[model samples]
Target: METSDQNAAVDALKDPEAFSVIIDRYRYQLSRYIQRLGAFDSDTTKDLLQESFIKVYLNLNDYKPSLSFSSWIYRITHNEVMMHFRYMRNRAQAFASEDALTLFESIPDELDIAVESDARLRSMHIAKALQRLKPEYREILVLRFFEGKSYDEISDILEMAPGTVATYIARGKMALGKVLQEMNITSV
Candidate 1:
């Protein structure tokens, strides 16, 4: 059977070398997540990821099996990105064009919108619309849709109640739809 993330955590506590398994498993997902959260540049994303991993390694002793390890790691990564934003004193930026395309592709089904012929232009509009959303809404949308996190997982990561996560997702979708409408990207 494949080792569960919880088991990996337990093993990593015993042998530090086992920690690499956890890092390897989470690196790509978390890196993409960091980018989605607004670390636009590769260097900044890599640095934040390194710092987050280090924090994760240091705090391995605190890993509670009751919470999925994925949630815990994501919580740590999310905090790191937020801290970076606070330190920089800047609002989160728009997704890179490629990421905007990916994000837009996943959104049409949810928004009940038909994929338009000019996907590039639509994607740019979507990216701009996403940037206009409140930070809480945008973060929840990214976690729920872009990162494919469940309500329970998002709750654990954001330290919010599951109901709040659901609420944010609903409101975020509505707000995103409104913004898209303002941009004249109507549903068909």
Candidate 2:
């Protein structure tokens, strides 16, 4: 049977080796999330993931049962990425092509492309448009759409009020739509 994240956390607190379960469960999703946040390259994403996981391990005691474990972990990962951007004194760079393709594919319901070839062509445009968005909008949209987070989860992860999370998501979607329109790709 699959152990719950809460159970894994409690176990890890008692037996450090049990932390491996937490790591195994979160590793791939968090790695993809780190990359989607525009970590430059695989090495950068790996470094950030290592640092974030270390933080998660060290702060295991701080995990409140009130928040979902996924939200709490995502919060840590988000903070790590923000700190990396601040340290580098640069904004998020464009996502790698594969990341872009995956991101666009994840939101097909919102961006209804009729053909696979058109989807491929529009993926590049969408990536550039996303790159052009305000960091706040981009991050919120990424969390909401690509990461498949609910508003409450986003609120917990972003430490924002639920209403504020909803507002940001609305504005972010509008901004993304406007950007795509400006690119003359209005299928969305």
Against the true structure, candidate 1 reaches a TM-score of 0.87
Compared with the true structure, all predictions reach lDDT values of 0.82, 0.82
Model 1 Cα lDDT, one tens digit per residue, 1-188? 87889888889889999989889999999988887777367788899999999999899889898898899999999998989989988757756677666545556355455535687877667667767888799789888877888899999999999998998999898888787777777663
Q: After superposition, how far is residue 141 of candidate 2 from its true place, in Å?
A: 0.6
Candidate 2 is scored at a TM of 0.90
Best by TM-score: 2
Which window of ten consecutive residues has the lowest lDDT sum in model 1?
106-115
- Model 1 residue 182 lDDT score: 78
User: Candidate 2, 77: how far from true, in Å?
Assistant: 0.3
Q: What is candidate 2's lDDT per residue for 21-87, written digit by digit as tens?
A: 9999999999878876763678898899999999999999999999999999999999999999899
Name the regions of candidate 1 deviating beyond 4 angstroms.
102-104, 111-119
Q: What residue pairs clash in candidate 1, if any at all?
A: none
Q: After superposition, how far is residue 84 of candidate 1 from its true place, in Å?
A: 0.8
| Model 2 alpha-carbon drift over 4 Å, by segment | 108-117
